[model samples]
Target: MKVVIVGGGKTMFFLGRNFAAKGYRVVIINRNMEECEDLAKQLKAVVIFGDGSNAGTLEDAGTASADAVLAITPHDQDNLVICQLAVNRFRVPRAIALANDPDNVKVFEKLGIQAFSTTHIVSSLIEQRATFEEITNLMPLGEGKVNITELVIGSGSPVAGKQLKDICLPDNSLIAVIIRNNQSIVPRGPNELHLNDRVVVITLPENHGKVLKMLTGEE
Candidate 1:
């Protein structure tokens, strides 16, 4: 897989490093020369110094061949334009944008771009922390319409030792993967949930609480 990351700073550096570690071809585009130099040295990626919102810049970054494009620039307008160009111009399979303002998330989604708002995610996490202790690594997708969450099964969990087919999950919710003792298992009809198993679930935001309650027995 090839990933093109737009913008700079810690997020770009870490994202580039993670993709490179996964053996994906990583390309980074940044407007700042110093940051580009730093990232080129720190990450095993092709670093291009230029404004990512520009078509020529994206072309230079090889966006045409990128499997995915991530636009995480500080400015929301720039991020939106970068994503649009990546999708409509380069025909990239996946394009994600960071919406600096929470209100822009829906707007980005309306324009056919996947977006997430850091402000919204942080606030949601704070609220969830007060009520749900068992849920972790909660990620909002589809502009907060969908969510991906992780929960661990304990001895007292309602779904513990139950086969996936037998668990009554909420509508639009699915246990995508179960992590047991450092191994990942794709959930099947006969796959049984075990104690200490970490399950990754995908569900609509409205069904999140219900799914958690069903799996962890927590209200």
Candidate 2:
């Protein structure tokens, strides 16, 4: 698969190296020609120096045939504009963005941008590891700051049958989505608690245990 990244930062470099090492074609585009040249040389990537939002630049970067486009600039507005161009103008099949602010992630999601805030995600993962030493499949938002955990609610749990609002979630934890019968549901307060439900939760490291007990049968 061909992937294009619109930024030449640490994250971009890491992604390019990993993908290129794994034999995927990668192109890294950046406004700073020096950083672009240095990173491209280090990773053996196809580096393009230009403004990512420009149609000509995108075309020159081979965006037309890219399997995925990632807009990960430090600036949120730039990232959004890049993503919009990739999706709307270039018609890229997949577009992802990097968000500097966690609060902005939801807004991006609402705009149909597949994006995440590295700071928020990483911090939550670190916190999760500190709290739940046994928890695995932590989404690696950071070394341990935030986490995306697949929590299972077994039978006879305290929260079974209780309305979602009644369940005491740690302030740091959020029930982002629920999966039942292979269907994904973005949870709302009106969604009632049910036994044997598997939930995908996003939370800060500190509040994972409380969420675990509520999710699994153990208190």
- Find the candidate with the highest lDDT and give its number: 1
lDDT of 1 by residue, 1-219 (tens): 999999887877888899999999999999999888888888999999999999999999999999999999999999999999999999999999999998999999899888988898888778766667777788877667788888889766988989999998878999999999999999799999999999999988677777888888877
> What is the Å distance of residue 3 in model 1 from its true position?
1.2
Backbone clash numbers for all candidates listed: 0, 15
lDDT of each: 0.90, 0.80
The candidate that achieves the highest TM-score relative to the unseen native structure: 1
Q: Summing lDDT over every window of 10 consecutive residues in candidate 2, give the lowest-scoring window.
A: 131-140
Query: What is the clash tally of candidate 1?
Result: 0
Minimum summed lDDT over a 10-residue window in model 1 is located at 127-136
- Candidate 2 lDDT, 1-219, residue by residue in tens: 999999877878899999999898998889997897798679878899999988889999999999999998888988888888899988999998888877888899899887888787666557656654334465746534576887666665677777778887878788888778888899888797677677788876577677776666564
